[model samples]
Target: MQNPKMLIVEDCPAQQLFAGQLLKQLKIQHISYASDGELALELLKQQRADVMLIDLEMPQMNGVELLRSIAKQQLCQAVIITSAKDPLLLNAVATMAEADGLQVLGSLAKPLNKELLSLCLSRRKAEVWPADFERKAPAFDQKLLRKAISEQLFSLCYQPIADMNSGQIIAVEALARWSQPELGMVRPDVFIAAAEQWGLINELTLLLLEQALQQLQQWHDLGVVVQLSFNLSPLSLSDVAFMQQLQHKVQQAGIKPELICFEVTETQDFTQLSAAIEALANLRLAGFGIAIDDYGTGFANAQQLSRIPATRLKLDRSLTDGVSERPQQRLVLENTIQLAHKLGLTLIAEGVEKLADAMVIKRCGINLVQGYLYHKPLTANDCTAVLCNSSEQQAAS
Candidate 1:
């Protein structure tokens, strides 16, 4: 993304000044500001902005509401959602924006730093947006999605999670690969939002689960017994029947529920998703590992940890990526590690890409790790090869 015209929607004067300085340092000159979302919308009514930097904590029409309004009115093309809130909240908001067809550069947690801002800006690809242009909806034929779910057409890619000390693969997280005819490969966030919108998310999740559980059983059959973890959307967990089917599917696969972990986010809406939350608790009680995914991203904290029945805590990549270099990040990571330990939750540090950071995480006592450092998400067959190869090497060592 180029240095296109940008608008900042925020209420805090000091934070606004701070953002201005960072933008200045980056030489982002074509800038404007609105004290609140309402004003921002009004200003954007006349002139369009290439990018909108939003502060989520604004008084009237908070950043999230602003994003909704922008998406509804076609107010902006790209946005950088900023907040003092946790990174999970930012990620959730970003997903929402993307689902609504807004091009999200990424999210930033304030107080903002120039390095991150520059990196996020570099991710922007320069594109000309006509004033009359509207954000494109997530394009997928409902029939196609329904067919894909029913036939189990969607594929799973496995990314290995390892015990850092022994350098042994202990688990693999299943990520969905959705490739549609003609449209080619769709972004996971985009397609997932589509699934929810079309009310096919439950089917989509079950199909993936069936495939993943079967794969895990195959690996176990071959004498490689490692756990399997996969994401579950809040919407997918709303129905008690889906949870029942999930358990039945595991039993039918001849896989022990203990070897399976279901990962869920700190969902967007807490009020309406009480049943889904309860479903997760019940899943935990049923001998399935329930992981509070993305622990340090700002949402899962001391308060949330004590309440949820999570057996595992997977640190978000955002919280661990630069922990070795940044004092503040290290501070947060260290504290989170202690909290999870005191609560007796299994710990896994995600995004352990660097030797320095990996050493830091290892020293911090996070034995389970996942990231590109070990392996990227690969097809089941390819991943099987990688896992077998890893086993051979570990045995030799």
Candidate 2:
């Protein structure tokens, strides 16, 4: 394992030197320093640093401005130092910096304690790489997915999203589940990206749709008005042939188009914008609902949302991060809900990993919440069983 590198950007000479000494003591061999904001920005332009430690009060541009600059450059590491009492400023600076992917590793007060510095450095090491898929599972080959698809080796797990208020099993998000014949079970995150890299995302997606629609048809026959929500890949939206095939398959399923929802991550670039919009409009006109998935995490602006013909907004998981600590985050959630309501769009919150998180979302007036707290994604049989049981209970009550 390579030793992690650190970038210390402090305005004061003593503080910068102190950071350097701490890095040396920690046995971190590769260390870089920026005495002021300008030099730090210049250094970033020359070479990317693994993690950046920035002082909030720097001359010329200041730490916040440097953080923003680092973000514009697409540099991903940052740690902020400010006075202990000024947490609000620390948070404000962190949020502003994060917009550019310059995530704050941790916050350290001035007159940094050795223990605190060690903790920050350790945290910085963790954030150095954005979770490598291959390293985690070296045996999982990207090329193997092509064979997997050809061999019909993958499966879909449908996680039901019941309306909290109505307790109605309205929709299910199709999550990819895989159990390798040799390796046993592989995480979807590990294999899905591999599939995309190996040009099998579209194939995997279509397979899921076919399975989902068939299951939906079966559920409908049982008198269940279940809607199946399929995630839209950037590739799927851009491919005309895929869209035509999808249209044909939906017709073949003979299910109400309105009962099928296409959930896409929000994007501002609008690549294949006309084609994507046209296909989405066709789907909507055909009675299918369209939703913007992972709403707040994208580059979508207010005007962009107005232009898109989406019927629902699914809040990103990041919105709920640290909600318990930061009361103001509730305002963001509140405003998002209010905006969704104002736009006449159904709102669903994603990544509800805890019951407390769900309660917070419910109290904030969100209509639907999905996360591990409710259930992990289930197989088709399990999903059907859940919906049927919930329905029976509701009728009894």
Candidate 3:
């Protein structure tokens, strides 16, 4: 693949020179320079850049305005925010860029290092072309979604969460999958988002929850005592009656509530905070474990954590992917693990694909981990087979 076309938007002449030299040293041929957001916008109108390196403190048009324009006009495919200002300000800008539907490569503190810059550039160059189905998937509507629910087209795949110390499976997170006859397989992200948009989130969530409970019961019958964790929509939390019904169904299925954990996405806004807190509090009271999913990805403040009563905190994959290689990330992960422990919460590091990364998490005192390093999401039968094999191995030993 050809190198990505890049634009550097910085007002400082010396910084621009430094960046230009570095890009040339890296053998990147197509590079453009803009002193401010206005010039950047003008350059973008002439030709689109695949990636943009933005300095937030530019004079004419600040990085914030440039980012807004980029999001409004869909200018660059990816962004790298570079700032020497407050880390909080840098993070706020990056978060804003992401919220505006732009792929932020990451933030870079001023005086960017060659290695980090190369890594960011490499990621831009390595993006895969969209698959045919992804490019052509039909827009889903409420009628079709309702039909999907009624036809039971949704299925569950479980990814094992393991004890980092023992390296034994402790729990499995149930991820939803949807297979439409016409669409082939729709990604859970796609369907789940659509479900939420169409006010079908509650129905879809309960369906997956029921399926997970049934499978957990089956595993129990086979003497495989593994806990199952599944996501709960924020919309579902507003309905007290629905939560009550969920508890009743779990009791009716002869499944212990302790065998299941409901993961609440941190990315969602709790418009009904009190109701959500009460709903989750009730679930925990009834013996269910609650986890704050994608913990570091969202804007949830410390105050929110105190109200939710979460039993576990699942670190987002972004923080876990290369914690060993990145000092800043390692520090953050270490601090997060420390905070979780202080709050009496279990810490599960997700997206631990590399052994080196796993080692880093283990060193940081996180005992639970989930990622492709252990197992990818598996069908119920395959997961059961894994459990049975583990049981056999233990018995033989």
Q: Is candidate 2 or candidate 3 better by lDDT?
A: 3
Which ranges of candidate 1 are over 4 A from the true structure? 1-136, 272-274, 298-301, 394-397
Q: lDDT tens string, model 3, 1-397?
A: 4577889999999999898888888888899999999999999999989889999998989999999998778677688889999766876687688667677777889898888888777655354323432233446777999999988888999999988766578899999998887778887777887887778888887788889888998888898898889888887798988888888888988888888899987445568888888999999998999998887775543555677889988888767875665576688878888778899998888988879899989988987999999889999999999887776666676
- The RMSD of every model to the true structure, in order and in angstroms, is 7.0, 7.4, 4.1
lDDT of 2 by residue, 57-154 (tens): 87788877777776665654655455444766776666676555655556666777677777656544355534442154546676677788777777
TM-scores, all models, native as reference: 0.67, 0.68, 0.80
Candidate 3 stretches with Cα past 4 Å from truth are 84-88, 98-106, 128-138, 181-190, 193-199, 218-223, 238-241, 265-278, 297-299, 317-336, 351-360, 372-375, 381-397
Evaluation by TM-score, superior candidate among 2 and 3: 3
lDDT of 1 by residue, 1-397 (tens): 4577889888998888888888988999988999998999999999999888899999878999999899878878788888888776777787678667787776888888899888767657666554334524666678877887777778999999988778889889999998877778877877788887788888888888988988988887776788899898767776889889989998898888899999987755344456866898889888899998877654555666866788999998767775665556677788988888998999998877777888888888888999988778899999898888877888799
Candidate 2 segments exceeding 4 Å error = 1-142, 182-184, 267-270, 300-303
Give per-candidate clash totals: 5, 0, 0
lDDT of each: 0.82, 0.74, 0.83
Clashes of 2: 0
**What TM-score number comes out for model 2?**
0.68
